[model samples]
Target: MTITIYGIKACDTMKKSFVWLDQHKVEWQFHDYKKAGTNKKDLQRWIKAFGWETVINRRGTSWRKLPEDTRASMDASGAISAALQNPSLIKRPIIEGNGILEIGFDPAHWAELF
Candidate 1:
């Protein structure tokens, strides 16, 4: 399976994920959203697969920085729109490959899935 890891290059979680993957000798591709931008179709697919609640990174600074009304008013569609507009709003290191889609970086979860 072709493994692809998506996230900003500088994220600490992303860095840890990369290190783990490297130590495990897993072949993968990195998709830097800052450089490549995010696709609506991919975002929608993530939302469909994992639910918007899982895909959206409410704990992140990007989400926290949003206006209160904006945060309060978010629905699935609104969340998707917001994520598309700001890639950082989506969870870090979304992994796609091997008929799997994962959000966030958890070594244990990755070990089981991969």
Candidate 2:
């Protein structure tokens, strides 16, 4: 199975996810959002797969730091655009494989993959 995990390298959740994959002997690719930035097309795809509410990391500092107007004024597309421009706002450990995408790191949720 081919997998791609997206997040900042230093993020604890990302680190844990990577370690878990390694421990399971799963082969995967890492997309470091800090360096790579979020892609609009990919974000749109994820949003479609998981829904914007699940894909966007509103709990992160990046989302909190956004200006009141920007955050409050955002429609679905606007929020997605913001997330694409600032990956820190796009949650951690988003794993995709075989056209399936999972957001966040819940070992129970990932157990099926292994």
Candidate 3:
């Protein structure tokens, strides 16, 4: 399976994930959402697979910086829109391969997956 890891390249969690994946010799592509941006279809698919709550980093500054109305009205679609506009709001290092989806960095869990 071809693995694709998605995140902002500058994020600390993404840096750790990069080291781990390289150390483990997992060949994968990167989607730097901050630079290249992401599409609606993939976002929707990810949201369906992982749930918006898992995909969105509500604790991040990107989310907190939003207007109160925007924050309060964040349903799945709202999350998708928000993430598209501000990729930093996405939790770091969402790794995916064929039939494989991982939302965050967990060394133990990744060891099992790898």
The TM-scores, one per candidate, come to 0.94, 0.92, 0.95
lDDT at 114 for candidate 3?
91
Tell me model 2's lDDT, rounded to 2 decimals.
0.85
Residue pair clashes in candidate 2: none
Q: What is the C-alpha lDDT profile of model 3 across 1-114, one tens digit per residue?
A: 569999988889999999999999998899999789988898899899889998899888888899999988888999999888888888888999887898999989999999
Q: Candidate 3: which stretches are off by over 4 Å?
A: none
Clashing pairs in 1: none
Q: Could you give the candidate ranking by TM-score, starting with the highest?
A: 3, 1, 2
List per-prediction Cα lDDT, in the order shown.
0.90, 0.85, 0.90
Per-residue lDDT tens digits for candidate 2, residues 6-106, read 99999998889998988888889999998988788888888887887778788888888999998788766986888877888887889988865888998
Name the Cα RMSD for model 3: 1.0
Candidate 1 RMSD to the real structure: 1.0
- Residue 51 deviation, candidate 3, in Å? 1.3
Relative to the true structure, candidate 3 reaches a TM of 0.95
Model 2 Cα displacement at 103 (Å)? Answer: 0.5
lDDT of 1 by residue, 4-105 (tens): 999999999999999999998888999998989899899899999889888999898999999999999988899889988899998988999888788888
